[model samples]
Target: MKYTHTMPFGAAVHDNGVRFTFWAPDTALIALERNGLAAAPMTRDADGWHRLDVPDARAGDRYQFRLPDGHLVPDPASRSNPDDVHAASEVVDPQAYDWKDAEWRGRPWTEAVIYELHIGTFTPEGTFVAAQRRLADLVALGITVIEILPVADFPGARGWGYDGVLLFAPTAPYGTPDELKALVDAAHGLGLMVLMDVVYNHFGPEGNYLHAGSPSFFNAAHQTPWGSAINYDGDSSRTVRDFFVHNALYWVEEFRCDGLRMDAVHAIRDDSSPDIVEEICAALRDGPGRERQIHIVLENDANGAHYLERGADGRPLTATAQWNDDLHHAAHVLVTGDTDGYYADYADDPVAQFGLALAQGFVYQGQASVFRDGEHRGEKSDQLPLAAFVSFLQTHDQVGNRAFGDRIDALADPAPLRAAYACLLLSPHAPMLFMGEEYAASTPFLYFCDFGPELAAAVSDGRRAEFGKFAAFGDEAARARIPDPNAASTFEASKLKWEEREQSPHREFMAHIAQLLAIRHRALVPRLAGQPRGGRHWRDGEALRVEWPLANGATLQLLAHFGTQKASGIRQLAGQAIYTDGITTDLNDTLSMAPGSVCITLQEDNTHG
Candidate 1:
């Protein structure tokens, strides 16, 4: 039998039926204020867990927590349903959803070219089924996986999925439970892996109801910019951690998802003996003896390698992958040269950006950061494989955080932007792209949400005023102009024009991305398959060269030019121009590199021959 952690017991949903549970360690009496059903008294267990089995409770149920004083609210441990965000939770029959990916094992992190996208804005329709229609486009572009932004139920049909309140439900605005399954099935049919991003940091301020029942799911010990930190190591913390771990496993097993990207793990604080992260990792590593390889990525700026390291038992724990923010910062600072905000720390050091991102994981390793005020340390990545870092030129936070909801195109020259693109994809690390970035879509990805009047005002006025206080990050005066969540235009401005791919410049850029992806797949993928571990080499700023040397004489050099200015040198490869980017193939012997192009070929002519 598989070992299960005993939670403080807020709520339980098994295959048979849901045993409504709660850990009110401090409560004298707890009642259930269920929606669509009559209120009932819950029986308290000796361990402070309240239990009331509802056999008739099938899928599509909406419920919440009720206090003894007649105070009614949503469930603190709601698998779904909070503030009517995405509708009520359903008792989904996991077995009913047929998965066609039975032959679809999994893709290694090293070989993955993840495309991070928000479902709502990915297409004109902005629905799960609508997004599924584009699966062929991603597959044709040589993308192996789609890392979706947080899809857990959040308030309204708009907004970034981060402020999710319902921990266990997929966002209803996207689609129904069956529709999500269909989307996953469609992706698998195209040989694409699907990764769902999940947030366990802190509940959004609008629909948080843990205070109504088990109020200890938060800690006053430390604070984060969003809200109070999660109760990872606080009183009755075991249950809180269990709640999240179960949610994570449910997505993997129940949804049959290929992987999960844990959002903002840095916000989780745990000084306990057996760390919450460790516990979660162990649960994932169960079943088959490590060959299954269900990927679990983390988004942390801590620059710690141990987070992805294995335990003494040979079980991987830290994370399979993480967002390489340093790479983004370096690339952004060099190409755009925007010397405001947090980027102030990275101005005038583009080569440093390239070198650090090449040799180590982050450029801010062990350096005194003026923005941070203290010396920040990063893990030594010399022995680590390059795939440990997942890089991108643009992401939701990097673009949406701007006061005006601007993208890189707003401030960067197209030529240099192309150069940055080559640098990102051709680098040793795994590369990711935001939606519509390949064709240089002009629409801005803004921050929008639908909340109650008071919360909406607090978010628009208060959040904007607070973020604007960081004059070091951007123009303080323009902060007031940040897109308001209440405005319909905010959501409309973020949608992608699906038809633009057929246009002139957009078509050309799209072709460039497709060519780049092919080269990476043909030249770089095999090296990882043989070596499993990744490798790289550094070159002058004029040209960045990465060599992945394998067991045999098999080796590959991912060559890319950094500057947008036309570059030419006589000696690199005399006759082969089979795979090239940003450069025109005049003939077999001569090559003219456009601003942001790259070439992938055998390290030596003899290898190809």
Candidate 2:
């Protein structure tokens, strides 16, 4: 029997059978072991790749690889792991699913109003099919893009997908591979571009079989906080690099995803020329991604400006944008007034820092990090376009990593939260919101996992120790109150309460968001899509003034007061008031704003008001 190979690796399905390919340079012997059948030896090439074609194998058939030591292991590039990560891999035909998004060309980064969500906690059913049913709700909420948390297979049914093991397979707990595709197709049908979060930094602690197949997969010299770093510059690095690049293409081409949000790219250590990230981005741009625009975003804690730098041709070097922690930290400190841990740096003159973050891509660019003992951090990003930064008030890490997994609304005053939301949505940069952020759902987004007893104890102890550094969680009793990651109730509690959207404050908040988004799409976004021609920001006592030159020969002005008392003596000279929240309604030469108020106005002239 013969099988046509579509991918360089993995289980490719054809009419006759499936073709299996594995790259195991360290292993001498390899065999294909199908369920309820004898093991068949596979032929190995000089490059250390083992291949075998089995005509009897079909879609839904379970199989594993037999090593020389007689140990059976799942495919390193399995497409579908119907069972747990430790179980056998199942064959899946990528062409079996009929998609209905033929006319869907993805939206650009400038028009993206990203909504990040975890499937398990997003819906009560916690399945891709269930989540698909709620796409219309998100579409109605003014979300142009959906950035889903990682969906790769993990050890158990529930976990924040950063700990995913099987890179190619969508977690079985969510739904079948085809069902996940359906979700993406449905989103495209509703004019929503879907982007998946892919983890290339490290694999989960459990169910990792890469070392068993090839020890060269990990670099022994470099050590990450999670474990040994991946071999991006060491021996046999070409194949190692290809594995990740191929995975990126697999998601884009097979799943019909518009983009990928690479998770924790700062943790990915690569010293070779033409860095792995650059290579991956180049591949995406040159491969199937060439047909449609694919936006690639990075989560880099290092604030590496090179990722957003443009070449001589004026094209970006690597990613389309990066998550701006500087913006989030400054905003969090200003609103919540929590000056512990990393937030300590922004404690001093947080308003000024927030203004800088809005004007520049990062406030810490080439500056000393007070939280790191005055160590210099971040590269200069002032020259980059505003679209190169992703600004958000709340994200999965910011909320779930908290001692009690509290959202911004839970920690800050209501007025300030509203002010913050207005600033976030109307800012020049791209903005993202957490799952229930639009309606302010009451459910907590906690960190929950389903590890075994031994690993669970270690994780629980480590989680407590991590928060112990904060003064608020220093008390042992407070630490004990933290939810256990292994508990089923912890995962259940994180599920969003969709019914709360009809409540009082929640419904009001939804209306506010809708109005903000309408103004953004109808007025601001069209004029400020890529970058602002010029911008200025200043701290006026407890209030902040931000001004940007619009593409239209007009000046956009935003005045926000974060102090408790009303801001008086503000001159009311403006063309049109686009948005005003919690401000005094006296039309005079002098304007007074209530505490935690924001006012945005567009003046035809460039003169200061």
Candidate 3:
């Protein structure tokens, strides 16, 4: 049933039927075209909205909108697209699906273990229903939340959902609305929270007809890689903001999505005029289901706390979580010792990297960025709960954006990889694992797009040009690095081999992740309580140690050795050896980490026993 814009969008199905109302101001005419029923043109109200009181429209009947040109299209505001990816939208009766999660309390950000995955490459079937069956596996793995990549309809049936054109419609390839619901239900049953990634920064190049209808949806004042930035502060922004707000609510209320991990929030350029994010948050929290909690996570490079701040009214409008790139950079540089691109600012100082990330939010806070040559900085994480900083050594972007999707497992020495994993997972920040990383899957996460030959060529060329701004690779090398976006082999090679979990080093890595997860669950549980109680000590050029104190009065100390070779000058404290990779402490009670080796706790009291 269509609900007017002035009136909050609500639905109720009676024996007589449902009444649908839509707000389309730019349209010359609007019609409600139901399946197998005579078409009825909706009369426009004073506010430019059209309302059709459909007495015959059943709860589950399919419908579409007939534009002024007699061109029928799927409803842009449709709650559910039931006819699969490329078919007509259905009139979803939101109450039709029986939700067993009435008593299902939502998970807090502090307790969240987010698993980011691409739907296309997540499983063998590569569909929502197929992914649903594996929720138990995630639940078994001690994952509290599953963050699915962007699902908005992109160009083809198979693609990374970030390049979406149909922002309103869920990708037809993922599954039907009911199927999505089933997946969410399954996740809920498994006690796993679901966070769907939503892209609002810019629309893809193709299938974006929003401009043809209304150019005001974007503004030229800000340009982004994807396209013109969204018209967040420009003309007709109220309606634009409403559109995205509705999209956010649709996922949570209709599809049972628990949260939204907003992709590239930094790209969402908005002026001082009518704070966009605040309004969006207001719209989501204003609905009938007042008591239900919905989480919002943002991916930003700035590491600014402004996005996490409340409104003038003191309302908590901050994102529930944000990706901590500093943590990734520190771990990447410390473990790999590769100082190319942004990594230039972050090598030879694991203590500085680890301590600052644990203390301040970013390592290069207010420092001149070697890559950009400008001042780049971040907020201090000391005031924020450790969980607020989402830590990950490897994510899809880190791996897939590379010349090849080479994971840490592909590196020569497994010891450094293992040490890096230990440092990342055992740290104070909330940890995230890339798919197949737990098992050290050897398959690469190559960049695969579903574009045709022409677009594929453009993508390859564009990728090389973009990376050329930072690194100097030959044209042939760059082109060779760009996988054919349209090739089936590209996507095929990206899939994780679940069977690898049983293999040699894969099994060993899995054991490590499992054990680390257990330790995190037991010791780190209290850190999720929104209290940031962590201590750190770092010598500017030598060593840095960060400590997370547990409720049991025990401490989880992370000592990082920055030198390439083991430093044996510091004193050694004799304690029950918990973890070490042939790395020992120095003469002055300082641990000499062998290049990438991480030594755990050491106390003289334990040695006396």
Candidate 4:
């Protein structure tokens, strides 16, 4: 059939048939192979987009593209890869699913209490439908946002999703694309906004077919740790940029995702004016039916405060927020006293480092980074609103990338861990909790993959070699004990033991977290959503004092004693004890705090000099 269509750059179902469009500028000839049928020539436009409308093809029909070299490739924008990443793409009707969240306008960024979870390991079933069963639990726990790890189709049945190759297809193991939508819809129904993590820096090593059709998808001038950088600023960059920008919109518009967490944006490497990140944010904001406010966050190691800067029109140029590693690093060091690798920088004065991170958005703003060979890093972001930072005590990388996959709670004493949780929840920045972290589930989130034998061996060896540099993993015995990424048991071991949520210490921890979140909702969130009145932090001996004036005629003060000895007569009395972790007795002008204790007090005196 020959007709013009206004659908997106992927497989779209129409009243008569399924229309397929792909961008392959480097290919001379392209054809469509539908349901294992003979290859049919596809009409090509001057813009290098190949189009084919097959009246016989309908929803559930399998299709693949035959390149100039006669190699079949899955659609780059496939919505559902039911078989696997390398298999044929299935035609899906986007409008077929019945969504009940029509009245669901997403929550604002200021009220976000994100809980990051890996879908595969979140539940025993490890599917979207299964994960949806726990949404009510999160709602009860006061989680406003749920940040799921990447769902893009990868090589095998299980992975961390960082190795996703088919960016559009939700992994088959987790369930169908419609099921994934159901999960998002269910979350929205419970008043929870769902944000998905997307990796655009580089495609995965396996099952990547973009190069078979067009080399312009990647840039030779730039390289990232993962692989070649995407051609965002190189020749034929506009098409490459559009491919990803459409993917972002696909999730937001088609899947009804509330937001996205762009992974490793520092590796994007664009020198062009109004960088690719800016283009993506603008496109998302200007998308069709832009009624719901869309939020974009960045996971940037560079601490790029510019990503959060507003343009002349007073809208954020790139992302609404960036992950604050400075806060995490300082908090980790303070709680565990571990000064290895990047944690070395925060070791000298963890409290001071954390204080700087609280007062400013970054601790390394023009300061020498001891881990980076004394190189000055980061830019000033103190003027930005606290909502521009996402702070957490533990994250996927912080916990899973460890040699033993030990969480902060596993490494620290209960007293300090509780204190750290108070700091994270009460901080001005938005706080996130890793899966199973609130109750301290004993399951270790080890790095697992499902690569073939050869790639699996290589991954196992590379993992060992990477961690071998650390003294903890230097011993041959310890190195041998590292979980093999290829092992099914390793993947199974990472699953959360939901039963533990009702156990002794786990129950206590959950209650504490619930109380802390209640306090945040009652006291902190209101003040945070208002005009950005700046805050202050100071250190006295081994104790830290943080005070921020609220919209009401009161000030919020957090007094934390990080030293081993008890701090006596730390500070004067306050209005009310909003939250306390390890403090005992009422507070007067001469209150004492046990070691590793934290108290959050509300002082009625807002005019303190």
TM-score of each: 0.88, 0.96, 0.86, 0.95
Q: What is the C-alpha lDDT of each candidate?
A: 0.71, 0.86, 0.68, 0.85
- What is residue 89's positional error in candidate 4, in angstroms? 0.7
Q: What value of lDDT does candidate 3 attain over all alpha carbons?
A: 0.68
Query: What TM-score, to 2 decimals, does candidate 2 have?
Result: 0.96
Task: Rank the candidate models, highest lDDT first.
Answer: 2, 4, 1, 3
Instruction: Give per-residue CA lDDT, model 3, range 50-85, as digits (tens).
Output: 777778777677876677776666655555565533
Kindly list the per-residue Cα lDDT of model 4 for residues 153-219, writing each as its tens digit.
9999999999998898999999998899899989999999999999988888889998888778888
Best-matching candidate per lDDT: 2
Using TM-score as the measure, the top candidate is: 2
Off by over 4 Å in 1: 1-18, 33-37, 82-90, 287-291, 310-317, 466-480, 530-554, 558-560, 563-601, 604-609
- Global fold similarity of model 1 (TM-score): 0.88
Candidate numbers sorted by TM-score from highest down: 2, 4, 1, 3
Kindly list the per-residue Cα lDDT of model 1 for residues 234-278, writing each as its tens digit.
877877787888777777765667778888777677887677776
lDDT of 2 by residue, 353-456 (tens): 88888877798888898889998999988777777888999999999998778988888888777888888898778899999988888888999998878998
Candidate 1 vs candidate 3, lDDT winner: 1
